[model samples]
Target chain A: MQPTETFFSGFAPHDLWFLGEAALRTLWLSLLAISIGSMIGVVFGWLLSVSRIGGGFVLSPLLDIFRSVPLIIQLVLFYNFAPIIGLRLDAFDAGLIVLIVYTSANVAYVARGGIEAVSQPMRRAARSLGMTYWQDMRYVVWPIGLRAVFPAWVGVALGVMKDSALVSVLGYVELLKASQILITRTQETILILAIAGAFYFALSYPISLYAAHLEDRWNQ
Target chain B: MDYNFHWRPVFKALPDLLQAALLTLEVAAISMILGVLIGLGLSLIRIHMKGPVMWLASIWVELARNTPALLQLFFFGFGLGAFGIHFSPYLIVLMGLTFNNAGYLAENFRGGFGAVPDTQIRAARSLGMTAFQTYTRIVIPQVLRIVYYPMTNQMVWAVLMSSLGMLVGFRELSGETQFFASRTFRIFEYFAVTAVIYYIIVKIILGASRLLAMRLFRY
Candidate 1:
């Protein structure tokens, strides 16, 4: 088939509406997942830094297991296992849950780094000032730690967005799955895929650019 | 459906799964080697290449870095076939992974290269070394030392990303697991086994890389 023939044939008028809906779903799902994931990551990360179990030599290996496992495998496990535990969710929910768990693992690591970046002198000074641990953390340590690791957090956020595409395999009507559906129905494989790629770029590039700006601004 | 946990089927599948695991390693190793070379070249261009070459390299790096590898794999696997250009699924997956890894690796390498102190380069030049010799003798070695940990992390990430190849029918570990699960209706057993395999592979790679880095780059 001629490339143009394939391209033109693939651009069905009605499919545009379907693609739009899919795009919206993808964006909504991704935003929700990332927001929740970030929360989990922040909390877990803070715990990792402050908790006694998180402080010792065992911390590295504990984090290692979370870091080493693939997010896709984690998703598959959740997708299959969630129903068995009475918390039944559709593909989208399962995907979001897995995203939270997987990205939290990363966030915990980033958060730990952020916490560590808070200088010892600062913590000592906070203690000397009669600030309680919570007060010191809330008023001083967390601020510095957050600033130090904001760039990495942004990168992780972007990672969550991109990794969201993996959820398409679980039958979520994500952008990639939408494109795959279009490809199968119309067989305009390249054009639709390119459009899908463009959609992903549209979704992710702005956040990345924003991250670059924040990194520069924060570093300055 | 009662989930029956059977060790026999999982054990019976081990040899085939091991073969698949070996293929996964083969693909990852080849892709990483190529990715490192491409990433090094790209880093050089980003740092030193003049004019359009630099601009193009930066754009490539940004585009690849921002995009998901799964989309890239699909594009290479399915998109190219529409244009009368065909490669095996394995090659397409490899190319996709290589490009993805190269972009990240380029950034890592650039960071490493930038971390090298200017004084060291100056000292090398002052010793009558040419630019190339100075880079190879002094700058590159030091940069590698600085970037060893991050590079190892990226290599681990590369191994994990290889799981996405299953989506394109490349029959890596994940692919084999999915196949067996579907055929046998042993979802948990198959996935759990493969997950364990993946964890083992990652652990071994991480451990090996750490030792190798310590030996190679120890000051």
Candidate 2:
């Protein structure tokens, strides 16, 4: 017990390796979730921004309800409910699905803003050139819309990375969960946590800095 | 076809949930108060200070803002135990919430401060106002008006994130919901009630903030 205790001291080589592995897992999950979620977000956002509420006030209300529910509740629902429907997922898969859906809700908002930022004059110009609505969107609207909202996408991406840690509640072996495990196993809680904190900082800082840079560039 | 909804259990659980809801409100309220003070101080330093102080503030803000609040809670709760700095679970939760909220609030405040036009600052200085007076009397009030919406948004996020306190054994609303779910094996009911309470709290906070903004900043 004494050697085992002494061997697993704070900042030990093996512990550092463990932390590194955890960080990698965290990054992987964040990337996977964000990639899938952002794709869905773009489509949902396009529809949200373009759809006219001619008669279906019902659609808007449903979107409101979906957006209002907490992400954690959504996670728990998918975790438990999916099994009963025979679409069983492991904890990781369930967490990933929850993150994708939850993040898509937010991304859709950003996307809508992005799409709406394109000027009416640009649309008219595209139409005058004999372009159809779909062609105008493909050739003119989307490019400008995406550029205008690039900074917003950066913010949303940072959000996804931070929220990825929440999946640890369901026992996923992400960086935060790994830190919890280390605390129980090695008893060097503070040092390991500090390392975990540094890992998160490493992941998030550059993205935020890049967002700030893009905002400056665009504003100028 | 045989399924029938029952309100009896949900109604019976209300008093317990309400007690826990009180705890949740207490945590969010206290943390937001403290967070605003600390955040304002940090924002001042970030904006007005030079060199090392600004860098230190930036680092602190980045670290707190970037990580998940749950990780911060765990670090403060379990991590501190290793350094012989144990806090009660409630205190740890409060500390984590305050630290996390302060980071975002500082940024919101910094953005607000930026919104204060430079010409006004120059005008105040030209009229023989000290830098401190210019900031307090001329800049901060205007900045507050500009930041009202974003600040409200941050407050809403803070309230929502407070639910994470349950992970560290703090018996806030989410924790109580988990307890009920496990005890009664009525996971769906417990969670449904939790979601409704959260939605109501968020809506109330938003409404109250909007009202306060109108009252305070009405020109």
Chain B only, TM-score of each candidate: 0.95, 0.92
Top TM-score model: 1
Off by more than 4 A, model 1: A1-9, A54-63
Task: Give the candidate number with the greatest lDDT.
Answer: 1
Clashing pairs in 1: none
CAPRI quality band, candidate 2: medium
Summarize candidate 2's per-residue lDDT along A1-220 as a digit string, tens digits: 4655353544468877887887888888889889999998887787787676721253445554445656666677567667656685988899988888776777877888887899889899999999999999898888888888888898878888888888887888888888888777678777778888888888788878888887888788
> Model 1 over residues B1-219: C-alpha lDDT tens digits?
455567678789999998999988888889889988999999999998889999988977887887788988888888888888988878987999898888988998998998888898899899999999998988888888877787777878888988998898889888888888888877777888888898999989988987897789666
lDDT (Cα, 0-100) at A187 in candidate 1: 83
Q: In model 1, how large is the Cα lDDT of residue B75?
A: 81
Chain A TM-score compared with the true chain A, each model in order: 0.87, 0.89
Q: Number of clashing pairs, model 1?
A: 0
What is candidate 2's lDDT per residue for B71-172, written digit by digit as tens? 788878887777799898789989998998889889989999888889999999999999999989999888888777877777777667777877777788
Candidate 1, fnat value?
0.69
